[model samples]
Target: MAYTFEILETEKIELVIPLVYKLNNGKIDKAVLMERFSDMITYNNYECAVIYDGSKLIGVTGLWFCTRHYSGKSVEPDHVFIDENYRGKGLGKQFFEWIYNYVKDKGCEAVELNTYVSNAASHKFYFNEDFKILGFHFLKKLKK
Candidate 1:
């Protein structure tokens, strides 16, 4: 199967919003997605890409560049996802490898991402890709 990755655009927001909602377990709404997409495009913080199998969009990934004090450098890779039906097809690795090369080329010192503790399959994938777990990330949801 031939797969291609393309940077996201405003015209593609409708297609990408659903994919992002599915990937995020529907925690985000359309307005939120629109706002974030707009910010990503405007500030150039978003490196959103869609994986296409022929004419179908089967996966999505977003990378944001940021500087980390611990890493003492700029890092990329904020999120990645593949449609449930398209998992285990090596697309995840290909996505990461592409992001790795792309970020490195852009002078990013590292690429990082987080997977939930319950996501064993993702942990395995990251391990296979030679990503070492640096530490645990904890979060507290605040009332809006």
Candidate 2:
């Protein structure tokens, strides 16, 4: 199978939102996500990379570039997902390799990502890719 990877253009982002929702377990409404994601792409330093097999979109990951005291220039890839029908075929590995090269090209000092704690398979995969458990990630939501 021929695979192609490209940075998705702003106008073409909707094509991957379904997979994004799937990654979030469909908890967030699409309209809300669309609006927020559009705003993010418009106002933030974020970009998405998509992998396609021929004409089919097979995977997507959102990359956010930032500078931290520990890592200097870093790229935190979020919303990583591979189509259900396309998983376990080594595509995720290929996608991450693409991400590493992409980050390196951007002169990033490191690449970091957070996966849900309950996702053991992803934990194993990430470990195999040499990602370590740096520390705990905490969050607190404020009421509007």
Candidate 3:
């Protein structure tokens, strides 16, 4: 029942890569992801927040701190995933509460996140957490 949350550093990101892949349906190559994540950590101003049950990792998400004219300081969390075995047990609620407090401590005025439209369960869960639908997240994947 005891859990911990920590802001992950670059050297430890591999610990959460498995859970991160879960968000993308396990389609990403581990080697490639590790390389890209390392680059992101090194250059893209992103950090990962990891959830641990005792010493074992149970969930992970990416956090990007930003400022906007309307929102001021905010933290945007992405790629959130809880271990399949740990879902639907109020852990997500605890995680978000922790994230809110974490962001506030960093002088953030808001927390924002995006979830895939087809993920209805997440939509309901987020709504239950008092999150409002702001707008659609449009993406255009450029050819590599």
Q: lDDT scores for all predictions?
A: 0.76, 0.89, 0.88
Per-model TM-score versus the true fold: 0.84, 0.95, 0.93
Given candidate 3, what's the lDDT at residue 45? 49
Q: How do these models rank on TM-score, best leading?
A: 2, 3, 1
1-144, model 3: which lDDT tens digit per residue?
A: 889988887788889878878788878978878887888787564878999999999999888999978888988898899998999899999999999988899899988889998899999999998989888889999999
The model with the greatest lDDT is 2
Error of 1 at 30 (Å): 3.7
Candidate of highest TM-score: 2
**Predicted structure 2, TM vs. truth:** 0.95
Off by over 4 Å in 2: none
Assess the local accuracy of residue 118 in candidate 2 as a C-alpha lDDT between 0 and 100.
87
Models, CA RMSD each: 2.1, 1.0, 1.3
Q: Which residue runs does candidate 1 get wrong by more than 4 Å?
A: none
In model 3, what is the error at residue 34, expressed in angstroms?
A: 1.1
Per-residue lDDT over 1-144 for candidate 1, one digit per residue giving the tens place of the 0 to 100 score: 778877667567567777878767888887898787767766655667778888888877777777788774455555567888888788898877777777778788876788878779989998998889888898999999
Q: Over the stretch 28-52, how does candidate 2's per-residue lDDT look in tens digits?
A: 9999889878887885779999999
